[model samples]
Target: MALVIGVVSQKGGVGKSTLARLIACNYAASEWRVKIADMDLAQGTCTSWNRRRLQNEIEPKVAVEQFLNVDDAIKTGEQYDLVVFDGAPHSTRKTLDIADACDLLILPTGVSLDDLEPTIKLAHELKKHGIYPPKISIALTRAGNSDVELAEGMEYVRSSGYHLLDGVIHEKTAIRRASDEGKCATETSFKSINEKVDQLVQAIVNRADELGKK
Candidate 1:
């Protein structure tokens, strides 16, 4: 069976789709057959991004499709090595479905209380619905260049008694530009930015592996 990963959020513009595409493309580049299930049907974010990627003829060729239901995505996912669900913004019944379906559920948020509060609350909701705490992770994204704020954000997640991923994806114009060109954060033109994103990616991979063993 394919390893399923979900990128979900309490609200939009919090790097949810960004993390989904990043994970899909990195696994695909490593020669793994990867599929991104774009659960945000109204937005079709990953679906449109894949179209641009194909047009650009980017390597490894990640497959992306919009699915109205989690069951259908899981059924289709069995054919690939990995399936990444780019879930819709805001909590819905489907959010719990994704939480139940995925081996790893990643919640990406910014440094502010606005983002952090809802992200942790969603995590709590998932737990209330019987989702394992270790199976869920919090990733800091679109962070400003303030070390102190980043550290505080990390502490907030940790203090909430949830696992926090090691690295932060600092807000960068280059990353946005790469996405506009159908590229992931790890595929940016700047080597430094690519490396920084890779740290978070590696942490994600490691967390998934650790969870799989349990």
Candidate 2:
């Protein structure tokens, strides 16, 4: 059976789509049959990115599917080793439905207050609705030099009592270029960022392993 992971956020521009693409590409490169389900039917960000990925001839083996329904997404998950879901900002119901069906849920958010605050609420909501799994995690992205700034946000997240991955993806121009070229984060030659992404992938896989042990 395939491992299903959903990347979601209540607000846009939190890098949920980017995380989905990153996971799909890297997992596929690792020899897993990976597929991405673009649940954002309106934005179609992942869909378009997949097209660009094809144009760039990057990670050709990774498949991308644009899905409008939860049933179809569930079906797609059954066909691959890993399925990464990139959901729309407004599609909470659809996203949660998929979450309920996933083995893990990745809520990618920026370290800034604007992005992190609502995610805290969403986390509670997901738990309340029984859609969040023990494997659910919050990934911090687009981090910058604190000088006390970044640390403040981290403190806030910690104080709020939520699970956050140990790895953080620093802001880099290479990430933008990679997206523009439809390449994965690791393909951008950003070794540091790729290392962080690798840590994230390992963390998730380890979590899944732990879950199966129980």
Best by TM-score: 1
Best prediction by lDDT: 1
Cα error of candidate 2 at position 16, Å: 0.4
Give candidate 2's whole-model lDDT.
0.79
* Pairs of residues clashing in candidate 1: none
Which digits, one per residue and each the tens of the lDDT, describe model 1 over residues 1-214? 9999999996999999999999999999888999999999889998888888889988879999999899999999989999999999865798999999999999999999999999999999999999988999999999998899988898899999999998889999999999998999999999999999999999999999998731
lDDT (Cα, tens digit) per residue for candidate 2, span 74-165: 78677788888888897779878877877778888888788888988888888889764466778887777663766776777777677676
Global local distance difference test of model 1 = 0.92
Q: Pairs clashing in candidate 2?
A: none
Error of 2 at 24 (Å): 0.8
Report lDDT per candidate: 0.92, 0.79
Instruction: Please report how far candidate 2 places residue 109 from its true position, in Å.
Output: 0.9
Error of 2 at 137 (Å): 0.7
